[model samples]
Target: MPFLLNLLLATAAQAPADYTEPDHWLCYPGREDICTEDLSATVIEADGETSVVDFPTARDPEVDCFYVYPTVSGDPSPMSDLEADETEEGVTRTQFAPFRTVCRTFAPVYRQVSIQGLRQLFAGSNKGINPAMAYGDVAAAFAYYLENENDGRPFVLVGHSQGTNILTSLIAREIDGKPVQERMLSAMLIGFNVAVDESGDRGSFKNLAPCKDERETGCVISYVSFKSDAPPPQDARFGRPAEEGTEVLCTNPGDLGGSGPAALDAILPAAAYGTSGRPPAPWVKGQEIKTPFVKVPGLISGSCMKEDGASFLLISVDADPDDPRTDDIGGEVQVAGTILRSWGLHLHDVGLAQGDLIGLVESQAAAYRAKD
Candidate 1:
């Protein structure tokens, strides 16, 4: 098993960390770090043919991406300080680094609740998790970025799971009605539930709404992915509204503003995502792909599923036994042999739609530049 699969949380101690310190940032314009690694991918067609795709970092990207990663910290403390580790780098490599193709990536290392803390939270025992401290660090980092790096350039906000939770709080309080909202391309909140009120209005944010169209600016795109076969349960951890008569927002990134069953352009790591503990059974029967990433174009499809007061991105794997390529993918949170169906495909939410997301961002960037 990999280190990421072993960790459920992380956190900080000692004096509060300073955001102005270069060490606190995971990636910025000129810094050479984990985010600067190669992001090239190999495209595996359904017929067992393969090709490589290069994702060159932009010398001068038009927009910036302010990313906050999901909880992968292995710290034992209640709250984590500004010390970054391989865990942070590893998650960013799989999630945030891919966006270098369209924008200058800006990632921050904030004090977050530790994986140990999450164990307690999941166990219904809030012993030592400090979410406020985590949010404070991220909030300060965003402020510092705005004051120091943002030169009136448009930017995108990206987060997953715990990061999404933190970003939701930030958006509700700071960005929703503020002047800075205008400069945002969109907020991609994955692997978490974003609530909307009984009236079907934006309960999460008063001013900013969910992104309905591809080029829609200053909006949000949020969803918790679930396997189509295993829909979220009544007491599922995600994909269900927080309050009665309310609904959790679900927007399919692959086919925004359209109806059922959109082909998912899933760009995942050549290796499996946290579950199976190995690389995918060679995409082609006898061929090997050397690229760090893999694009299985039509192996997956998704739709916005809303029924029984639960809303989520219903992912369906189009498994064809006769095809020479592998048909199975991995993302579930399993314990021993038990698959946590409620978690669904939470682990691969961002990775599965990485290509479609980049496309959407590019479209929004072009649209934003056209108006400017």
Candidate 2:
């Protein structure tokens, strides 16, 4: 009877919570930062009846963009952060509710979804302690977003870090080899590689750079910055050249279609967020650079540089691309995907002095105004 009583007591201790009580709950040890409070966000919903600022004039009513984030937790948990709401019925992410807010910026019909919960899907029910599974979950969220958001209207997809991996899968599964080509405005899969496999060319499609030509349909703008020698193509994501046969098709951001940098610059700054300056913390000892184009040991910074028009400038910072140390969740699974086994050396870069990316989002949406 004593043994049975202990087993029953243990079972009771492990029971699922019928509700989440954050106020009284001790989610983490005292004094540890949750990091959730750091995200800057604003929510707006436009059902086409509202008056939203149009583009170019900086006041277009019909523009929509979707920004997806990656796994912050070393492990996975229910996607409570992305879309947490309370109804008399129950708490829900609402899955597709953010579209009303997302559509306000780009198109009359914009949508944004948070697939952050997918980390759990990938890592498994045990709160995404599995790496490979987390990756799969990321991919699934991309697919889900593509299929459900705005009913296949022209939209742009943006992601960072693990979010970039999900973007790559979306490009491969939906855009690259499929018929959804017409519906895509563009995809920005930053901070990760977009290749068929680790050994494949740097890009999956023909146009390596961001397309700026007036005649262009859909294009991808991707890059990883490096302050030194670029890593092997398979090792890092953005900086390498497109597949050998493929050329980086670009419309100089400085000269979009029939305009020059002045016209582009006028439109680039409004969407600006975050400082362009390097992080406050210095790179690990000996990582500073004294010259341009000097490749850092184990770091990769190659790009599909153009020779004709104003080539885009890529500024890379030295860092471990896929730091295994940061993989608090799914450490073993990451090991299986070869992500953990490889050197974490990666080049981080951003399009510098070109245009405000947030503004670029507005401009791109403007370019497609009449088409919709």
Per-residue alpha-carbon lDDT of model 1 for 179-249, expressed as tens digits? 99999999999988888776555878899888889988998898888887789887677887766777888
- Ten contiguous residues minimizing lDDT sum, candidate 1: 1-10
- Top-lDDT structure, candidate number: 1
Looking at model 1, residue 311 earns an lDDT score of 87
Per-residue alpha-carbon lDDT of model 2 for 221-277, expressed as tens digits? 554333223232343323333444443232233334432222222111112112212
For each candidate in the order shown, give its overall lDDT on alpha carbons. Answer: 0.81, 0.34
**How many residue pairs of model 2 clash at the backbone?**
37
Q: Kindly report which residue pairs in candidate 1 clash with one another.
A: 8-115, 9-114, 9-115, 10-114, 10-115, 11-79, 11-80, 12-79, 12-80, 12-81
Best by TM-score: 1
**Candidate 1 lDDT (Cα, whole model)?**
0.81
